[model samples]
Target: MEPADAVTPVDPVARIEAGPEGPQIGVFFDLDGTLVDGFTATAHAGDRIRRRQARIGEVTGVIEAAMRYRLGRVNFAKLLERAAGYLRGESLADLDAVGERLFQERVQSRMYPVMHEIVLAHQRRGHTVVMSSSALTIHAEPVAKFLEIDHVLCNQFEVDAEGRLTGRIARPVIWGKRKAAAVQEFCGRHGIALQTSYFYADGNEDIALMSLVGHPRPVNPRRELAAMAAARGWPVLRVENPGKGNHGGLRGVLK
Candidate 1:
């Protein structure tokens, strides 16, 4: 496959505006490294560390799991579970509140302007925009609310009776192909045609959903995804500025 030279970032909103728009058109966007610049989970993890919530052993475990997953040794679920373990016993409410504050302070300005324009174009056309990532509700919901995206398909934490994190992800980790399936199911439920929908992402894990959508828009794609996009002639959108580079994606840091 050729390199993504032919797929450099271009303003694609004009082409999008030419397409049919309605609630039946589902437009999916990956959270980190696609819609936003840096990883939101990075901020979340930093907050945990700043407050002395993350233990040394847990942080080491998360980094190790992330490395293993990157090397294709451990599964994404393992990486996510390992990271999620650090949040045990934390109040979900507190986490949510901090997530909002962190977004305003750390994540909001990092959003890529190009992606924001694309999202608004989709909204103007009345498309059903969704936030789809393995990032937790804390990391994803704020962005969804800010962007006015009504639907979200992402991993979530399970809590005990008192609304404390159980250190376990709720069933069905929404990563890779599972994330793809979640989108498909949502489209089915809403009568949105997948063949006409669009998916924008930066990670190789997003390839599953990318393959299924009519438009596989790769935003700042990592090498593997770049290669795949080039081979398939998918339109790749790159942000050349510093800090906009794909930082191993939300999967690399999210709990």
Candidate 2:
């Protein structure tokens, strides 16, 4: 199947706003595990596969291959091609509708309180808040709307002439170093300074993203990332569980 045409560019004013100090502060957040807790949107896709509601395993396998390729165990282009082949005939409207329902039902309730607070704080400070995730942008959009973030950087599925999915991505999948590239592109286009930006992430795989920002914080970090944070002296924060006063240096990190 032929790949779908690129999505019409969203207007800049619709996605970003000029701050009083002219983009002095921009906050970048990684969605899974950083903002939301326990579950990820990908898991919802897996559930759909199990229920036979979607042929998502084909895409999931491609994602795994891409992960292996990132770790230098496989060929990158081949993996992307293999993954893109999965959506060659899906109805775009139906996939989007199902994805929205899955996001609301399975992913919305898992958000971390501390992460929500941090996002709100950035908004209050007049900073441009953006979310980046490996999940499809369709899946991320509802959450982004709910959080009132300024923009989202995520993978996009290509659609055919009839508005059916071509099972291909319009852009390279947003992951690992590619995520950093997306951020740079966004910053360049928006005239935001990278060195004044803040990034929050939970895994070492996101180290490239962390390194790009002037201020990087590891939030509810995985074991390996937490260790790396300690070695690098980057601030570490834990999402406060219910009934637990904020702890683990989150208060200071936000300040």
Give one digit per residue, the lDDT tens place, for model 2 in 54-83: 655765685688589768797544564565
lDDT by residue (1-255, candidate 1, tens digit) is: 112345233457777788897899899999988877767898987877898878889777877887888789998787777777778898999989999999998888788766787899999999999999989999999999998998989899989999999999998999988999999899989999988888989998898889998877888789999888768877767664435475322211100
lDDT of each: 0.82, 0.69
Sliding window of 10 residues with minimal summed lDDT for model 2: 1-10
Q: Point to the candidate with the largest lDDT.
A: 1
Which sections of candidate 1 miss by over 4 Å?
1-10, 242-255
TM-score each candidate. 0.89, 0.75
